[model samples]
Target chain A: MLLIALALLQTTPVAVAAAEEPIAPYAQSNANAGAKPFESDGMWRAFHGREGVDRIVDGLVERSLVDPRISDTFKGHDMVRLRRVLKEQFCHLLGGGCAYSGRTMKDSHKDMGLQTADMGALVENLQAEMNEEGVPFFAQNRLLAKLAPMKRDVVER
Target chain B: MRIFLIMLAALVASPAAASDWRGDGKLVLTDGITTVEGAAGGGIATWAVIAGNETERGVGATAHASHVALPDFDLEAYGGAVGLFDRVELSYTRQSFDTRGLGAALGLGRGFTFQQDVFGAKVKLFGDAVWDQDRVLPQVSIGVQHKRANRGAVIAAVGGADDQGTDYYVSATKLFLAQSLLVSGTVRLTEANQLGLLGHGGDKGDDHTAQFEGSAAVLLTRKLAVGGEFRTKPDRLSFAQEDDAYDVFAAWSVHRHVTLTAAYADLGDIATVKNQRGLFVQLQAGF
Candidate 1:
């Protein structure tokens, strides 16, 4: 009976999680998103809800990947995980009812040797994507206001 | 000394190679418009912001011209400024005040012009006005302006004592991105009359007095801002009472390299003319 049980266990395969490349173990919280969520759903609606925000995040990442100003910073990093966390972060900040599961801005950008120009480049890319979604200029600033403060932690140099 | 010169050149050129330090990088209009005094700020008030679009790693330059047409006078200023690594700013401006018909009334002949040259320097001390949105700290800087006027005889005839003087100031500026608002305040010490156009010192007194300049603006869009400013002046001239100045202005970023500002300005009094209010326009270009 024991030998038969051992053979069955050996044949069973270990599950590969669909969450993408693993990160080191750390506690996750929505607070890791940095700023507090908008007090109302107007912001979320302005962003066209979940689908819109996800597209914006993916679009920003894609643009940054090709942007020579900051492309090297993204090289060799797990973009799949980055896209996922960034979406979570934007959704939560926009009041889309999503929880963030990522490291602090300082931790995530650590050792990147990023500069102010790099931060400026990332902001421009994000702005272009937001504009692509037809977000109004005023509402665009509302989101930018929330993200601008993160520059303190995002730019190490 | 030759080796040191080579090292200095490398120190500056290596960064240029690394970052391509130029324009089109800073957020729109964060550089502010050129002040009439030639510093980088509002049309009338000085802020703690550097002069150009350069970040912490680059060099930037700006040139500007401004005009104010009053009921009895015309004021014009033209100048340029440079920002080094967003750290130090050096500037120069030539200003001319046309007394118009008032010149004849004051016995200085018709269309008499009071010319002055202002040389200014500023250095950033601490904080990041734009990026420190999460912190209460504001960017601060100290500056000095050496002003020399051309109409020494006219100034002395009007009870003035000197044709040249220096003004010192410390400024603080803060930007609240969430509210799309920017505010700046400056405290200046000087003995000049009429912004050093008439001259320095007076029969009233030659002691340097503290003056205040304050401004607040709302960001209407990425390329537009509307604001108001108030500046207090010293009542230095015994021959004519001097008053404060104020303005309400609109600044538009028409392109990456151009900014145009229009204002309703009030200079209070000039020489003997009272309620000197009028239209003011300025254009600035930067890289």
Candidate 2:
């Protein structure tokens, strides 16, 4: 009888172990019809799908009044370089990840003939625009910190 | 060695010792409001015309008093200033010029007194001395005053004609912090021989006498300042040869809105007259 019982247990294929198997709650939804694997973990999927970059880019285009020649030059030449400049400046100023990769500040403004009064006007314009965009004063000052040092380079007069 | 001692003696002496004139400070240009009385020393004279830098963009008010240290005469004066939005400053002053023994010489009463009132206004023009750290042109200001001689008969009888008119001028004030001093100078086109209402009146000339006014205030502590002022006057009116005015003064900022100023004043040449001494005390409050 013991021999017969052992044979039956082996054929039953570990019923206790089979009953204890863990079931994934989201497995069915994740497997359904080309669903992304990352969606299995809802947090990462939400971050990857966010539209932060697009909103900031649209804001820049709408608010900034670029010089016609400068805008045309940016549009005609390497879009990648122009995009990088915009992203880098905005990200650096607004406290984002991108590092500024451009000409040394002094080299960039070598022939600009910028004066203190001109700088002041620019600052005033920027402040007004930032205010319209609901940027807080504290954040504005933080952005100014990144640009103020360049005054020595930008202001030739 | 002798020159060094002379310089050392000059610093320790009283009025007319050393003439180290300077401006208030670079930071003072935010508004027309300025420290009351001289920035330092305990002698007597009103301080700078304006209060703060143009950046402050606020109104300011100040009052100052001082006494003169002339030979035998004594004088006392009270003055106040009102600055509007860093653009304009209107000032009013009342001065009492007393003659001790001089009154006897003039055949007046045993103790005669001359009094006057001054009304002043200042407007700013282009300059970067207040805001730009790298600029040399001090913030330039244009000012004018209507002098109304109070003792008309007394002044006319003593000095010939009591000229009452407007005294207009321009002033530039700059502060050199690295040197711990302030420098200011003014040019006035006027007929008044002296600042006194009893002196020669205004409507004097268009040539504008280049009267240099300067102050050297040492920053003893951040809140305490000690200094003196030397101002040259135009005696274009035949009544008197303008005697230079000088004072030793001290000022204290008790709080952000309040300041107390005290000084010993020596207003020179009252209608060809010299050596008028007096005491001045002033209280200034601002919003």
Docking class of 2: incorrect
Q: After superposing candidate 2 on the true structure, give the runs of residues whose Cα lies further than 4 Å from its correct spot.
A: A1-157, B1-56, B69-71, B201-210, B236-241, B263-281
In the range B160-228, model 2's lDDT, one tens digit per residue, is: 245466767777765443344556666666656556455554334323455666665644433455577
In candidate 2 the C-alpha lDDT for residue A100 amounts to 54
Task: State the lDDT of candidate 1 residue by residue for A70-105, as single tens digits.
Answer: 899998798768877898898999989989999999
lDDT of 1 at A110: 92
Candidate 1: what is its chain A TM-score?
A: 0.87
Query: What's the number of clashes in each of the models?
Result: 0, 53
Please tell me which predicted candidate would have the highest lDDT against the true structure: 1
- Model 1: how far residue B223 lies from native, Å: 0.4
The ten-residue window of minimal lDDT in model 2 chain B covers B21-30
Can you write out model 1's per-residue Cα lDDT over B1-287, one digit (the tens) per residue? Answer: 24324433543443356445634457878889988898998988999999877788787777788999999999999877877788998888889999888889878899999999998999999988887777888899999999999999988888888999999999999988878899999999988899999888899999899999999999987789999999998888888899999999999999878999999999997887889999999998876
Q: What does candidate 2's lDDT look like per residue over A1-157, in tens digits?
A: 9579546534433343343323233322211211112113232222221123323333344333373312332233333333344445555334344445554556545676544434444554455555554554444443444444456676675
Supply DockQ values for each candidate: 0.34, 0.02
